[model samples]
Target: MSLGDEHGFGSESGDRRSDDSFGGSGQTRTRLPGGGDTDVYGGARRPVRNSRSLITVVGVVVLLIAAIAFANQGGGEEGPSGDGAKGTGSQPTAATGVKPVTGKNGQIPTGYAKDEQGAQSAAANYAVALGSDGMFKSATRRDIVQTVHDPAVTDGLLSDLDKAYSADFLANVGLTGDGSAPAGLTFVSRTVPVGTKTTSFAGDKATVEVWCTGLVGLAGPKSTKPVTETWFTITQNLKWVGNDWKIGSSSQKEGPTPVNGDNRASSADEIAGAVQGYGGFTYAR
Candidate 1:
């Protein structure tokens, strides 16, 4: 089963971030590997966790993404404007569509075809990378932004992202200055792409939308900020750089959010166990 199902989340997926735990979306949260539940990039004491499904402080994680453009800024559904030829577009949520490529440069995927399908695959993979908990760390965040973003905007975008993930931002999300959870709590922040559609593909520029859902917050028996899910759509502007696709920019909007279901919310132990039981994947069309 997908990690989402192993946890309490059902199939399908957010912001491109919200603190609210959406019931049906497939977003799952994870804790950074360290130690007050956060590792010292801190200014306040953390709440204790005893594990009874506390819903309070769930919204505390929103600031981590809201400050980033990927969470607050977004465009309409219109494709790119130009004179390039356009296809009817492929099915985004289908189990299989685009052919998968097998390779990676560093940790990110590489070698996508130069067609509409490639754009969709690239967008999906990038959405996963951008929405991962790695963004909370300086070293990993730089690697992500630098590798996925076009060279022209890499420096500036990195600077912006650095500023966005400030110590204050980390603290707000229950993370310490170094981006780790407390002694026992696990901080979860993950994004799951439900579908991908290339809205515009002309020349080396393509715009793709990744409909996704995510989860963020603290998970522990006595924790008040239980991990919660969120829904959001990521609209990305990709540029064919070097021999592969790179993101020029991207923004997120709330979502074509799904209705919350009657599925039972699991205990903190279940959520944390689920995280440790699995690893992430290389998402494709």
Candidate 2:
């Protein structure tokens, strides 16, 4: 294995500056409660007080009020709109309309709808199937290739992958000649999608990028390739085939990776136990 880059989720904030420029010696004039200036008829004169600190405080308050108003303008009951909206189209991040398919074509998800959501769902599920440990087994690999790939590309892809997952490759990853783990070892190869985005889309075709984290290696004592995590992005070019989305072509890139954390690595037995105990999910957008 080739380990890919890892990505992290985050939000950004901006700094605001306060305006300190005010006219007339930076002093504010306040009128006294009673009169002070008298005009001709001997009336009480209006007292005038110049306070710089008060003026500065008032200015700061005004700037704060303006900043608050500007910040709140895009929020509240109306929800996010315009450029701040969640999604590019009618579909929101949360699930909507038709549910994901429960049907499968020999372990690969099948029968997605003819819409964007369906395409995304198909891509996400296909990524998981393609990255699974089953791909190392001849029979299961063939099934996955046939199920997910386009009919025209399936044969070529199977031939290419058969070469790619050669005996040497299997040995390097601690698998046997037939892609089986050693007597006491458990092979772990699984992908979990963090998120999905549609890069390009049309009525019958779509390009979806699935940001994923994966685990791969042997989980047992004396295993050289111990189970470790990797991050990558899989871009699937899908076509609406036979009422469902099928992978016409697919590629993987390193990642929008983040820095590694300080978590302690689990032991071989622990890794094996976890892999056996936990189950994967049917991912959807």
Candidate 3:
């Protein structure tokens, strides 16, 4: 089975001082002929200086002051809140503040809550574990399957996966007979969650689709299967088991992918370094 086709679940501001002086020094003021009260230009004696104009200017100034006061009172446009948007009223893209489980079943995260959010979290975390480079190894692969799969189906799933990730399959992706990279190469398989949606959820069951982008292949000079990115969605049929969420079954499909941009691909060494340096997260929604 094609792994790619199957699992479908898936700025500084400067302050300026204002000058109060209306006119520059050494500028001469001309007086009108009447009583030095009007200018020589005689522009209708400044129109008797209407009190209504003064009132209107004062009204405008008052309105501006009120606006400034209201804005300051409302905290200046309600910028991004703790969850990262201004007045969005939407849930956070990722879980926060909720402490991760100290409990793990082998390498898989465990102790998830018995709720829809918990099920989504479990599926997302499991997707990462299942898509990691560790899945290529016999020991870790078995651990992962046992941890994530429903107990009733674990044995058969393991058997199927063993055959599916066979020596030839490993070799095609640049691993040796024992699933090790060539001496100079670093094998990479990493899945990063883009988002998750729960298509169906109940107390006892859940179906979660995890959208992800992954990097797989071998990273190094002279490697044939140079690491490349792919997008896929993994749909996991999960059941509430052992007080947590476990995978009953899963299938993957290609993608609701976007057009690739013009970004220059990173060098193999750079990719290797990055994979080694940056750690993956325990995803939740």
Candidate 4:
């Protein structure tokens, strides 16, 4: 029962910022010390829960149970990267054969490594996966929901991500009913990590910061979705469970993002066509 799941759904927002209930500056939404409901933050009014603060507490219990089940199911998959290694106390070993993805949950198993480098690599890749265009499709979304997320957190996160990437949002991105681009157009939504850092780590818990640059828009004539780029930071509060790191909670904020470079902006049609034709990569450290 991750705190996220206990809440029922990610906090509702009034705008794009609202969709990111965890980051924007608003009143704090807190689950009560006991089971109940209450509103903690706001811009537009949303129902609030003041339930037992034990929501996250309970979610952890559920997570512990799920992890055990997951481990028992397959003895837990080993970290997909290198054997834990230490160097001149400098950068970490870049493990080969890193599976950016495995099962559908979108959980990056790379984080449970025995060392820091492994964690960093895992965190960066996980962030990219979470923010990728794959999040838009229903099938992939199901896989992501099952594979990457903690079971306790899955219910809530799935609901939120669903709303955040709803049909209306797909239309906003100039996609058809299933998030597919119309003929002669392309759709893009990807996060490119600039760097990653561990802000804090303890036992199986870590806070990893992923500095990323992303592009999101539809490229096509008469498309309203412009191929625009933005910078943001994704901070994931991860926990080591079932032999890998799983996001307990996550947040995103507008970045220390730099000014636009001299890169010429492409027309909607050009950008859309390229997006339709080109493919995104599985990012790594």
Q: Which candidate is the best by TM-score?
A: 1
Q: List, residue by residue over 97-181, the lDDT tens digit for candidate 4.
A: 4433332222333434645555666667665554444444666655644555556677765665555444654453355667465
Instruction: Tell me how far the alpha carbon of residue 251 in candidate 3 is from the true structure, in angstroms, after superposition.
Output: 1.2
Question: lDDT value for candidate 4?
Answer: 0.42
- Indicate which candidate wins on lDDT: 1
lDDT of candidate 2 at residue 244, scale 0 to 100: 79
Cα misplacement distance, residue 260 of candidate 3 (Å): 1.0
Candidate 2 wrong stretches, greater than 4 Å: 1-97
Full candidate order by TM-score, most accurate first: 1, 3, 2, 4
lDDT of 2 by residue, 124-221 (tens): 77766655555556776688668877787777656655554557645644567776777777666666677888899999999887776655556667
Error of 3 at 184 (Å): 0.2
lDDT (C-alpha) at residue 231 in model 1? 59
Model 1 stretches astray by more than 4 angstroms: 1-66, 69-98
lDDT of 3 by residue, 217-242 (tens): 55667765545554555667888888
User: Could you give candidate 1's per-residue lDDT for residues 83-178 as a string of tens digits?
Assistant: 010122222332255557766765567777888888888888776666555555677667866777788877765665556555764564556776
Q: Would you estimate the TM-scores of all the predictions?
A: 0.68, 0.66, 0.66, 0.61
